[model samples]
Target: MPIPERFLDELMARTDIVDLVSESVRLTKKGSSYWGCCPFHSEKTPSFHVVPDRQIYKCFGCGKGGGAINFVMELENLSFWDAVSVLAKRAGMTMPESFGGSPDAQKRREKMLELNRRAALAFHRWLYAPEGAHGLDYLRRRGLSPGTLTRFGLGFAPDTWDALIQEMAKQGYDKRDLLDAGLAVSNKDGRIYDRFRNRVIFPIIDVRGGVIGFGGRVMDDSTPKYLNSPDTPVYNKSRNIFALNIAKKSKAGRVILTEGYMDTIALHQAGFDNAVASLGTSLTEEHAQLLSRYFKDAILSYDGDGAGIAAAQRAIPILEKAGLKVRVLRVTGAKDPDEFIKTHGRDAFARLLDKSENQVDYRLAQLQSKFDLTDDAQKVAFLQEAAQLIAARPSAVEREIYGGHAAQMAGITSESMAQEVSRALRHRLRKEKKQQERRDLAPAAQLQPKARSLRYDNIRSARAEEGVLRLLLLDPALLSRMDDLEGQEFSSPLLGRAFDALRGQAQQGLSPNLASLAQIFTGEEMDHLAQVASQPESAANGPRALTDYISIIRGEGLRRSQEQGDDLLLAMQKKYQKSKAYMEEKP
Candidate 1:
C-alpha cells in the first residue's frame, strides 16, 4: 500500500519549501518570491525562484520546478519515497507503516543493494584465498598495503567463471539478482556467469556507505583492460565517482580528480585522501556538480598524455560553471599519477600539486603548443585564438591578467591583446543576443516542454489546457468551474493525466498543490506541471479566464474529433473505390 495522501499533505505542510531549498541554495528575497542560482544546473545569474505562498520552487533557466519533495529529490538524487522520508524526518513526523511509492521498485532497489554488498564481501574474502593469489600479487606489486586494501574494500575475482555466481547463490541470492546488481552477466544460449574474473576489484560505495557497484581491472594484458558495472537500479556511473565515499570526508579542502580507479586508489594510499576518479568515462557536468558539493577547488590530475590534455580542456568550463576553482596538475616525468608517485616519490608529487597551474594558464599553454610563433601569420592566428579564450573568462580582471600572459607568449603588446579580447567579447555578446532574439520571436516555443518527448502536438488546445491548469492550481476554489471539463479531453496525454490527478484531489476536498500530486506524477511530469503553474495566470480574473479556457479546450477537442473522423471517412471511401474498380474489371 502507498502512503496516504493526507500524510503527504501533512508532511509538506510541516516542511517549509524555502527552508528546505535555502539549505542548498543561497536565496534572497525579490518581491514576494526568493531567488537564487539553480543547484540542479549551473548558472551565473539567479533564475531559480521559490514562492513561499505556493510552496513550490522553479528554475526559469532549467525548467525544473516542483514543491519541497521535488527539490529534495533532484538535489540529493533520491527516489520519491526517499525524498519524502527525508522531509518527514526533518519535520519530526513518523512515516506511515506503508511504503510511499511502488513497493516492488523499492524492494528491488533494496535487494540490489544487499546483493552488491554480499558480492563485495565475497570478492574481499577471495582476495586472501589461494585462488586469488595472482590478483593479490598484482595489488601488492602496485604498493597497496593490506591496510589500504582493507580501507578501500579492494578485492579480487578468481580466474574462473561461476566463482562469484556460486558464491552469491550460497548467500541466498539468485542469478537474476546478481545480474540486476551487475555482478553477473548472461551470454547467448541462456548461460549465466560472473562479470568479473581474474581481476582486482574496487567497490564503488555511495556517500551513504552502501555498496552500489564495482569496478574491475584485469591482471594481464587484455582487450578491455577495465570493466565497470553497467547502470543498474542503484548505480549510475555518470552520477558517481570512485572513492568519493571516503574522499568526501577528507580534511583537505580540494579534490584531486583522476582519470581511473587505480590512480585514485594510488593517490589515497599515498596519503592524499581527497582524490577521486570518473568511472571509465569523461568528466561530466553531473560529476562536476557532485564534486562542487564538498570542495571549493578541483585539481585535474589527469594522465600526462594527449587524451588527458584533451579531457582537461573539456572539463575546465564545466567545473567553472559549477562554481569550483579549477587547476591542472602537470604530471612531469611520468604518464600518470600512480607511476609518477612510484618513480619520483610522493613528496615530489605533493610539491607538483602545490604548484599546479590554474586552468587559464594551462589552457593558454595548450593553445601555444598548437602553432609556430616564429611564423608571423601563425603568430597572429595564435593571438586571435588566445583572445577568444581569454574573452571567455567571466571576470574582466581575469581577462586582463590572462591577456597580458598571452601577449608575452606571442611577443605582442599587452594593449593590442586587450583590444583583441574586447572585440571577441563583443562578438560573443552579439551572437548570444541574436539567439535570445530568435527565442523571443517564438514565444510559444519557449512555452513548450523542455523534454522533447513531452511536446505538445496541438498548440491551440495545449495553450488552453495550460491556462486551465494554471488557474486550478493557483485557485483551488475554481475546481467547481471545471465541472464541464474532463482530463481526457486535454490534447496532451501528460497534461491530461495531470489534470485528472489534480481534479481528483480537489474533488476529495484536498488541496490541489504540486506536493499532493507529486506521489502520482513522475519527476518529469511534475516539472512540466510546475512549468504550467509558473505561467502567468491572473487571480483577479480567474473565474472568467477559466471559463474561457474551458470553452476553448472543449471546442478544440470537438474540432480534433471532427478532423480525425474526416480522415477516417476519406480512407474508407478510397478503399471502397478501389474495391469497386476491381469488381468491374472482374465482371
Candidate 2:
C-alpha cells in the first residue's frame, strides 16, 4: 500500500530540505540557491541546484528534478511508498495507522539485518581461535596492533569449506538467512559453503555502526586478493563507507580518503582520526555525498601507483559534485597511507596533509607529468583536457587564474587558453541544453509552462509575503492580529493561494505547516515557495515587512487580472477609493 498523503505531508513539514540534503551533500549558499557538483552523475562543473524555498532540487546537467521524497527514492533506490515510510519514520509519525508494506516484507528485511550482524560477530570470533591462526598471523605481519584490528572489527574466515554454514546453523540461523546476507554460497550439489575463506575480514559499517557486510583480503599472495559481499537487504556497496563510525566523531573538518580498509586503519591508528575508505568499490557519488556531510575538505591519500592516480582522477569529479573542497595528497617515498605512516610517522603525515593541493592543482601536476610540454602537438592535446577541467569551476576569477597557468605551462598566449576554456564551457552548456530538450520532448514529460514559472526576481517578492504568512501561522497569537495586513500582498498565484490556504486553516484552528501545503501544489510550485519562505528576507526593511508584503500581494492580484483582460481590478480600485472618501466625509 502507498503511504498516506497526509503522513507524507507531515513528514515534509517537520523536515528541512536543506538539513536533509546537507546530511548527504555539503552545500554552500550560492546566490539564492545551493550549488554542488551533482551526486547523481560525474561532472567537473556544479550544475545541481537546490531551491529550498520550493522544496525541490534540479540538476541542470542530469535533468533530475524533484522534491524531498524524490531525493530519498533516487538516493536509496526505493519505491515512492518506501521512501515515504523512511521520511515518515524520521518525522516521528505513525503513518496514519493503515498504510505501507505488508508485515511479512518488514519481518523479512529485519531478519536479513539480524543474519548479517550474526555473521560479522561469528567472523570476529573465528579470528581469535586456532582455526584463524594463519589470517591472524598475516594481520600481525602487516603491523596491525590488536587495538587497531579490534577498532575496525577485523576478523578471520576459516579456510575450511562450509565452516560459516555450519557455524550459522549452530546459531539456529536458517540457510536462507545465510543466502540472504550474502555470507554463504550454494553449490549445484545443494551444499552451502562459506563465501569468505582463509582471509582477514574487514567489516563494513554504515554511519549508524551497523555491520552491513564485510570485505575479505586473502592471507596468501592470491590473485583477485579481495572479496566483497554482494548487495544484501541492509547493505549496498554504493552507499557505505568502511570507517564512517569513527570518522564522524572526529573534530577535524578535513577527512583523509583512502582506497582500502588497511590504509584507513593505518592512518587512523597513526592519529589521522578522519580517515575513511570506500567499501570495496570505486568512489561513488553516494560516497562523495556522504563524506561531504561530515567534512568540508578531503585529501586523497591513495597509493602512489598508476592505478592509484587513475582512481584519484575518477574520484575528483564525484567529490567536487558533493560540494567538497578536495586536495590530492602525494605521499612521496611510500606506496600507500599505511607505508607513508610507517616510514614518516604521524607528524610527517600531518605535514603532507598541509601540503595537499586543490583538485585543479593536483590534476595539472598529474597530467603535466605525463604530457610532453616540449612537443607542440602534445601541448595542444593536453590543453583540450586541461581546459575542460578548468571550465568546471563556477567562479569566473578562479577559471581565469587557472587559464593563465595553463597558458604559461603550454607556452601559449593567455588569450588562446581563455578561448579554449570558453569553447569547452559552451560545448558543455550546449550538450546539457540538448539533453534537457530531449527530456522535454519525451511523451510523459511535463515541460514547464512559462506562465506558471517563477522567475528569479519574483522569488524575492513572493518570499516576503510567505515570511509574513509563516510567522503568523507559526505563532497563533499573531493570527488574530493578521486582520490588518497593511502591506502584505502575494506576488504569484501560488503564493496567493498559499496565503489564502494559511488564512483559512488559521481561521479553522488548523496548523498551516508548509509540508501540508506541499501536497496541494506541483513540484515546481512547491520548490519555488520553499526557497522563498526559507530564504532570509530583506533585513534593512525593518517594520516595513508588512507594508512591502501588502503592496506586492495587491499588485500581483491586479497584474493577474490585467493579464486576463478583465475590468475587475479597476472596479475594485474604484470601490476602495469611494469607501475611503465616504469614511472621510462621515467623520
lDDT assessment of candidate 1: 0.85
Query: Which tens-of-lDDT digit does each residue in 1-587 have in candidate 2?
Result: 64444455457777777777776665779876797766666555677788766566777666655668767766666545555666778878665436534444555666776777788888889989999888888888989899988888899999888888888899888777888889888999998778898888998877866777889998767866999999976788988888998999899888889988888888888887899988878999878867766887889988878999999999987787666789998888887768877888878888888988778978887878879989988888899989998997788898899998888888899999999999999998899999989977863323222234544235545555666765654454455434434332355566667677666655666555544553455555654554444444543433345444545555555555566555787864554455344434431
Worst lDDT run of 10 residues, candidate 2, spans: 443-452
Best by TM-score: 1
> Among these predicted structures, which one has the highest lDDT?
1
Clashing pairs in 1: none
Candidate lDDT values, in order: 0.85, 0.73
Off by over 4 Å in 1: 1-3, 14-46, 68-101, 333-335, 339-351, 444-500, 506-509, 519-524, 535-587
lDDT of 2 at 268: 83
